[model samples]
Target: MGQNTDRRALVRDRFDRAVGYEGAATMQRVAAQRLFEKLQERMEGRVPLRILELGCGTGFLTEKLRNAWPQADIVATDIAPHMLERAQQRVGEGLCYRIMDAGEPDVSGPFDIVCGNLVFQWLEHPQQAIARLGRLLSPGGILALSTLMDGTFQEWRTACAVEHEESGTPDYPSAASIGEWYPSLFNGGWETEACVQTFSNGRAFLRHLKETGASVPRAGYRPMQLSALRRSLARFDAQGSVVTWRLAYGCFQKPPRAGVFITGTDTGVGKTFVSACLVKAWEALYWKPLQSGLAEEAGDTPTILSLTHCAPEDCLPPAGAFQAPLSPEAAARAEGVTIDPASLALRMQEPERPMVVEGAGGLMVPATETLMMCDLAAQWGLPVVLVARSGLGTLNHTLLSLEALRQRGIAMAGVVLNGPLNPANRETITEKGKVRILAEIPFQADVSAQSVEGIAQTLPSWADVRGGA
Candidate 1:
């Protein structure tokens, strides 16, 4: 058998022998409780719901879910039959306990919710499992799960290194990896909240893992001798052993909402202003992935906040920044850094809530030597809301911008003309470009918060763009 198959068999045997597993899995229970609360927040009192519970070991999450929503139809699944046997004994009536692998879920679903706690860490390709789980959900359904991320066993890893060895803990996913995978896996937006937990001492931490049946070594991992382990434990710090678990609570909704990437014909063409107006109009959050001129200017974030009267939390910090006012690539080079355009990933928040994202400059602006600003938009899979001027030379710029987006296969949400209303230019761009004029913002003399709010109200709903309504 292959490594993953062998690992699965070993993990099943470990859990089968772990009698009284519930009492030893304190951390898992705590994580499950938090996940349940998040599920409640997402459901918002909707009843007669259908739920699919992954890795329902010893009924830890199943029992809690049953208690919370008695009327909800639930299917509780686990890879280990022994674990499912215990879960069945604990929760006899409300749920269907099945022996199922979460990574390759075989059960039928169109479920309103699919939840798993401390489960993804064991899967060989968690990103694939997550994508599969997403497919099982009904339209507008929610996928909420808590998984162990990288940097989990920091102290243990350090101690092992001191003894010229490796820690036996399973390799977990990292935050950076999750940030990259989320965009590709879920076309709909998603968000993550991270939590950390600590233990008393090295031995106690190891004991917790063993009693909870999670201490199974990785595929092909060799066990260290007792003497070597003792020597490694001796290196534990004075403040007690620390196991830093990075738990990412990810929430994604199905029938995905469309996200709009707001780009302009040129820099300083009111992209931020348009973004702020959209935020005010739709109550959507604003994010700028790359900010190049932060050291010299207040930047887009402050401008968005001031113009929208939105709270500080409404705007996310730029993913990459530099001191120079030049293009992102040039600024990064000036600062002795190479910008990896693929490295800039968006941080999602409640998928149901819409968001307006602003790009650094024009559609063809270089983010890196090999990537342009439009490439980032395409990567995000969001429709483009082309922001253009309403004056002379507008038609050529607008047409070229639209064509660039089309070549990249990025969907056009619609176009917004930001300056004085030009009947002829607007008609020409819409007619020739073959895209609707979603809105035309009359040139504002004051450009105050109130004026921005009024303009926001004049804009069409983002749903019209997303739903192609």
Candidate 2:
């Protein structure tokens, strides 16, 4: 907590000194313009959007938003007071201007759109921050932002590498990782572009960063000596270097309606059964995004079909089905098939009935090299129903799963405890994890359709699910 506070202080101090941001923010301006255009495309036909803009440095993007949608109730905010003041001076009144962290917005939400420009990279926990922001959006609302990505400043990085010196540039996340940050219920993706900016020499590049207040290095980095820095600068200048700014523009939207994303503490936990109960209870659509282990056993979807007696059309096809009995990522690789997470992110169209999405394995299990089962849940923007065994080690596993979901700000419908009843385990999870005990399904000698129907009757209503939805 102290470290995070110190880091935020460092960022605030740096940006406070960046009085020249308006003049020096070339790439920032370009990104703001493009971000606005992209947002315009997404928001077409939707009027009077309740827009909340994060890190509105000097009002570059805020101005565009204002001019673009005068009807919008624009709430432009920043962490630095100077930047907020500068933005107020640029765009003047009507739009609410506040000095606050994007991770902790003081304003109420259900905002039609939440946006930012060239500011996401500065967040300490970009993933967690995005999840928190997603909570602020209205139904069908979007969180749009552009940020510096991993490949940015490669020229300077190469120069530093050649000079055997450290570079001050913070390591940015890749587009794939950024995509994973969004809540599973939200249909989110990023598009990348490399915008090149030329500077006279290495000193100029360093100065440019300072002018834009982007000089904050990653925490715990040792600064190079003046001599070493000068040498690296020389190397950078000698290389015919023009810096490449790898930018990723992302858009994540809260669905107008969604259901629960069912996952488990472990692979063998009763997620399939819990999902079956929910589908049967709500008469909802079921989608198993990635199915593995065809070689070993029948997948969850078929079992769900038989258990729920759901129509074939109600069972949404698996986005990626693999023959190997492994994690989705590993299974895809073994089968020589590339699965795009964006391709897998399908929400029901005008969902009249709820949809239950069942994930294979545990939350941390990798769906891809860059995405986890949890990331898919966050992306889909549905409230999660974390199922766990109700005995012995269940306490730790259930708490961990709850914490993971809380950290991502993924809405939770609650935990469904399965197996032999452990009142102590149930009490501990409810008290320690601060999660509702959605259901307690005891062991059944014959787990059949009749039993499932009885259990489904005990589950919460659609309104309960939508409460978190």
Candidate with best TM-score: 2
Count clashing residue pairs in model 2.
13
Highest lDDT against the true fold, candidate: 2
- lDDT digits (tens) for residues 1-469 of candidate 1: 2128878888778888788587778678878887888777766676637899998888888988888888889999888898999988998876788888788888887798888888877887777777777778765567788887787777788889888988889777777776433312233332454445566667877888888898898666798899888877777655367666667676654433435789999877778888888999888988888888878888888888999888899798887788899889899999999987556775567666787888989988898888889878766656678889899988999999988876554557788897887999998998889788989988888888999988888888866655421
Instruction: Tell me the spans in candidate 2 whose CA falls farther than 4 Å from its real position.
Output: 1-3, 260-280, 283-469
Q: How close is candidate 1 to the true structure, as a TM-score?
A: 0.57
lDDT of each: 0.78, 0.84
Error of 1 at 224 (Å): 1.6
lDDT of 2: 0.84
TM-score for each of the candidates: 0.57, 0.62
State how far residue 122 of model 2 sits from its true place (Å): 1.5
Q: Could you tell me the lDDT of residue 66 within candidate 2?
A: 93
